[model samples]
Target: MSPKNLSALNKTHKLLLNKLKDKRTRQIYNKFEKYLNINENFAVAVSGGPDSLALSFLAKIYSIKNLLNVKYFIIDHKLRNNSTLEAKNVQKQLKKFSINLNILKWNGIKPKKNIQSIARDKRYELLLNETKKFKIKNILLGHHLDDLFENFFIRILRGSGLNGLISLDKKTQNNNINIIRPLLNFEKKDLTYISKFIFGFFVEDPSNEDDKFKRVKIRSFLKKLETEGLDKKKFLLTINNLKFSNETIKFYTKKNLLENTYFSEKKKLIILKESFFHHSAEVIFRSFTDVIKIVGKKYYPVRGKKIDSIIQLINNKSYFKVTLGGCVIKKVNQTVIVSKE
Candidate 1:
């Protein structure tokens, strides 16, 4: 490393290690290290919450121990009047521990509907831009076990399929940037413990208590279920089982793409032979979804219902052309053609 970078990293090392003297912090750090097991330089998205604050400390230790550079960022969506102030306060608190943070602002008009979802998308857009600026491939997030349960119930309520039910894996990639959640197995209480012991402060977002949001409502429902008879460990086992099933489907999906679909890279198109539809509906469904995502150059797959309609049309051996998810699907003779629109 250059002398300039080395000096800066040294400062960061001293600031984080000084706070790591606590036994609880060290214990959590060891667990985090085991889960992460990474030596590459990375970036972290901090929200000033206990979860994110705990993540920042753990990531700092990992970076210092591995001699890798890490940058911290706070996305100031400015949705609330005190959002920027809260971001600055969090920044000041981290600086005392030797961690510097940059606040990324969401500029321009904000969405009136789906406020939470839109804000989240904007936050990721800002964070991904930083990842490109630093040439970092991994961005750490602080989603704990409670969040895992919350997301599961949310997907269930939304009538999501198997994939969506278990989408929040430990490691997921989006738009070429890896989103790593190392704390998924840990509880929220543990993260809160870490933040209190290490920084002695953490910000609480009011939206978490707001019942108007679907997630908050689901969280409340989960609490009721727990009071009645929600065995968290058993519930987690169910999720693991579902994940295994999802993985099996993914395996076949890849196989179908490789064996049945022919791609013309030069033309940015895919040819789906009759044999492609020979597999089960589930396998073919996932395969088509993958093809559409690849051809359409979209990070997210097309909706399940829309994909189902296309599959039905193809199964009937009908000649039709339809555009969905930025891909145009046309039937010619016994073959199907999919190309970017």
Candidate 2:
């Protein structure tokens, strides 16, 4: 590298680091550092919203401290007319800090219904492709404490299972990609303050306020709850207690998979002993999903209702063959086998 360019880079780094001198931002960084103990290079997903902008800043500072490479990407879903413009504006703003933001556009037919969920899926697809291109294993998200609370209520209204209700976690794996949310414990208001103070302004999404969306409605409902004495501290305590119980279930599910099923990697097959079906319903259900994930090569497993129906068919049949999750399942004698279709 030329000395001139090196000197310019150092100056920009110094300027970026100076932002942490502010007492409030420093406190937030300290708390963020405690949660993010990662040692490897990672990618940050930016949405131009306050939460994501704050994430880009925090992740950039962490990468500088750890001497690890970091990539920032913003996916323009192109769902709205102004999405491309917003993405470009965000990229221009981040450039002042020497943070080069990559813009990825989603080019496909727009969904008429379930737009939010489908757009989220597209964002992950683009981000996952970037990870594969760079061979990076971790992706940092901007989900905050408010998102966690909203997800909880959203799941409840949807009649979600216990697993679904508590699925919004700090760390989760999508296929082999590690999805990390370091700010899951931080409140949205604090993150907004950081973005506003450092970047001067951040883009806003109109969908966030539109009443047609369930999340928007839920956000309003939460504000009402707060006015009616909803204590976040107490709500957080309840979530923690549920997490403890979830862990217990996960332990048994893992045990069931290890003890009752055998995976022949060379054969690309999984063999399930008759005893696999003898465990408690939750354990059996979870164990089946684990196998499906492996054989299906899917990040998320098939829906629970379909799995339950298949389990019933397996139990009632003397001998059967069925296809699910790109896997061919057959019962021979007393053993069940699962292999790729």
Candidate 3:
């Protein structure tokens, strides 16, 4: 690169950093950085996409300014023919920024169903392996506001419960490794602007435009909604309100769990006695959902019909079992039991 071009790039980088040092970005970064602790050594998952690329750039700046150690990881699922080339390009870009990069490749057999989900699981597995090998505790992702909104709508469309509508958390613990999202408050458009103006980075994945993907369909639907005068700002405000409300409900739900539920560790069974059922059906339903979540099953709010069926089984003369999402709910003498079967 020419000296003049390098100087221009540096000027652009400074401008982009200053642009991101605003109220929203600062608030989000503070929450995220505190969770991941920008002062400590960490690893970032970079997929060479705009979101992750922006995160990588910001992480690099933060690490240098704070005298912290930060590493970059790119997982090659190797599902597509060009995955290797994409991974190599990501490594090349990180090298330009003087960031340490590691590429983890999946060389094993692929699963048969839902390749997207399978690839995501494999990607995280590779990340977990890296964290364990390097003894790194924090992992940063590039999930942005758009992603959260999309997730919220997706869950809603799928009849998900409050937990699903909660969308991506700012911080979570996965297998003892801390996962943090620093860009959740920033819009995808803002990240695109930063990537173009500062880093001169761009990525195009053909799969994103493929209409066969559920996410692509959702994106198109949301875009149409936007054109019909549905403001994303207002939608996000609704999500924020829903998130706060869900937290309050979860607080009570947790209390109910402590007071009403019993777990047989030896049998891996959870029991809810008749005394617990004396409360409102809403509470009972939420408690049931919570139990399912505790056992690592995805929770969807039970419809009135399903809830009625459960109530019938609970009140019946004969033992019966109801199953959903790999969770089994059984009626056992004066009590309702839930367990993984």
TM-score of each: 0.90, 0.94, 0.74
Candidate closest to the true structure, highest lDDT = 2
Cα deviation at 126, candidate 3, in Å, is 3.1
Clashing pairs in 1: none
RMSD of each: 2.6, 1.7, 6.0
Superposed by TM-score, candidate 2 places the C-alpha of residue 143 at a distance from the truth, in angstroms, of 0.7
lDDT of 1 by residue, 1-341 (tens): 99997787678678678766778778888899999987788999999999999999888888778888889999999889998999999999998766889999998898989999778878888899889998999999999899999999888887888898987899977767889999998888889998998889999889999999999999899889999999989999999999998999989888999999899989999999889988888899889998998898766677788999899888786688999999899998789999989
Per-residue lDDT of 95 in model 2: 91
Candidate 1, position 310, lDDT? 91
Task: Identify the runs in model 3 with alpha carbons over 4 angstroms from their true place.
Answer: 1-41, 111-113, 133-135, 259-290, 293-341
Worst 10 residues of 3 by lDDT: 295-304
- Maximum-TM-score candidate: 2
Q: Count the backbone clashes (under 3 Å) in each candidate.
A: 0, 0, 0
Query: On residues 1-341, what C-alpha lDDT tens digit does candidate 3 reach at each position?
Result: 99997786577556545745666555544554554555567889988788887788778767755777777898888778998998888788667656667888899898877787778867777887788788898889889988997888787887777767775888766656878887888888767765665467766778899888788888998899989998878887888888898787667777788888898877777888677766666566677666765544332234545656676667664577778545688776777788877
Cand. 1 Cα-lDDT = 0.89
| Candidate 1, residue 205: how far the Cα is off, in Å | 1.3
